[model samples]
Target: MTVPAFSLRNAVRASAPLAGALLLVGCVTGSDIEGLHRHVGDVEKRVDALAKQSSSKEEVAKLNENLGKQVATLLRSNADLGAKFDELTRELQTLAGKLEDANRRLAQLSQQLAETQARLAAAAPPDAAALPTSEATPGTAPPVAPAPAVASAPPRGGAPSPADLYAQATADYQRGQFELAREGFEDYVERYGRTDLSDDAQYWAGESLLAQKKPREAIAAFEKLFKTWPESDKAPAAHLKKGVAHLDLGEKAQAIVQLQFVVHEYPSSDEAKSARQRLKALGSDSR
Candidate 1:
């Protein structure tokens, strides 16, 4: 804009000098006046061209400003999308935990029922199979007395089933009885390690230990889960907990390693989001 305006001013100045020259030379001819008019027309055309070029430059700048705003808006939208994804990940983890507990309970009940039926069937058949088909004669070998029936049902008092044990341990954890919950969960995993809830039990045991301020023990518990149940659904959470345990013990380097593992290994998991947050807090790379 400034360059065009400067050219226009200089053109006006030059035209003034020409008009003065025309006035000074009273003998100027019609042809000379015509030539001067043509010169003025050319100057006018040049000014118009420069003005148009300046306008085009302004329009280009406006377009660039709009593009920058759009880019900033897109970046904000992407951040919002990432936050929503983290929320969904947390919700999915919660639902999966609930489903796992339900399955464990149902499976445990079915197994206990089948075992009871098998025991009763085995106890009753032995008596019949031992009896002789014909009546016993005096000289005949005396019929062997039937062995005592093995009890199928528990006595009036008995320990709870695996399902009940797990439920009680979860209840204790919910009630803030971390020590008791830790013991119960460890016991379940030790005795019923093949059960569906074993991995879940082990994970909760680590949680219990962490809650009790025993971060060292909690790290061990979480490590046990990783070694014994590497394919468990709770592996991501276990990694996250282990990282937190390290933090509690002021083991910054180890904590960062564990947190980064979760972020890289389970990027779509809720635990990964938590791990990233922790990594960011520690001034480490989350990726």
Candidate 2:
């Protein structure tokens, strides 16, 4: 039987060059057609691969954009944390300053208390009853004419009554008898609280309290003098003493207040000068 002839019209139109060669060679072989078909399939695969590569590039660019945003966010968060840390450090510094001020005031108060206690101890007098009597008398015997009636002890110097008492107290105070001096000064105040010397007595009383380590009591005494004799010469000194007592009591604000009053209210007074010096030592005075 005869084999049917393959159609060449459609096959030649698909590849003109190949069809021309085939016509020239008198016919196209199966191996040649298969090679051309395989070549066309490879070109299609290369085009598809290029398209996939372009898509991957676009995806990579999007990932990069997302990473940049994340980095920016992290930077902003770090800046905020840094600010918070600075604020906390400043607060700690402020608290430390306040504590230092408090401690300074406490130390001042303690010193004042000790001084007052020492003064009080030195002022006490010996008991009179403990001394031996120089003479004795029998009951109902007229005391043998009373030993010729001895004269009374004369007052020292020609000073005023209050001045005499003050002098005696001053002597005892100079001798380191703080308790005796304190009693004498108190007695003078009781007898002359309305007199010109009363202010002086009050001032000495406060000093005696301070020397006896009773700073709280000394402060009270000084305060009384200030309030009762605000226009007196002792006012400035009283305020100064009050400041010292307040310092001893660990009241820095209160002590500063009193010291400032002495410096400002009595700027020309000697006490004001002393207050200024003290304030400078404490690092509290600016002017």
Quote each prediction's TM-score. Answer: 0.46, 0.43
| Error of model 1, residue 140, in angstroms | 73
Q: Any idea how many clashes model 2 has? A: 22
Model 1 over residues 31-140: C-alpha lDDT tens digits? 77777777777777788787788889999999999999999999999999999999999999999999999999999999997885555334321222332334331111
Clashing pairs in 1: none
lDDT of 1: 0.76
Candidate 2: stretches off by over 4 Å:
1-161
lDDT of 2 at 284: 64
252 Cα displacement, candidate 1 (Å): 0.7
Worst 10 residues of 1 by lDDT: 137-146
* Candidate 2, 1-287: lDDT as tens digits: 42212223233345646645775686777676667767656655655665567679889999999999999999999999999999999999999999999999988888887775555344322233422243221110110111223444545665346656776777777676778877878887887689767877777778778778788998888877878787777677678878777766666656667879888887887777767766665546825
| Candidate that scores best on lDDT | 1
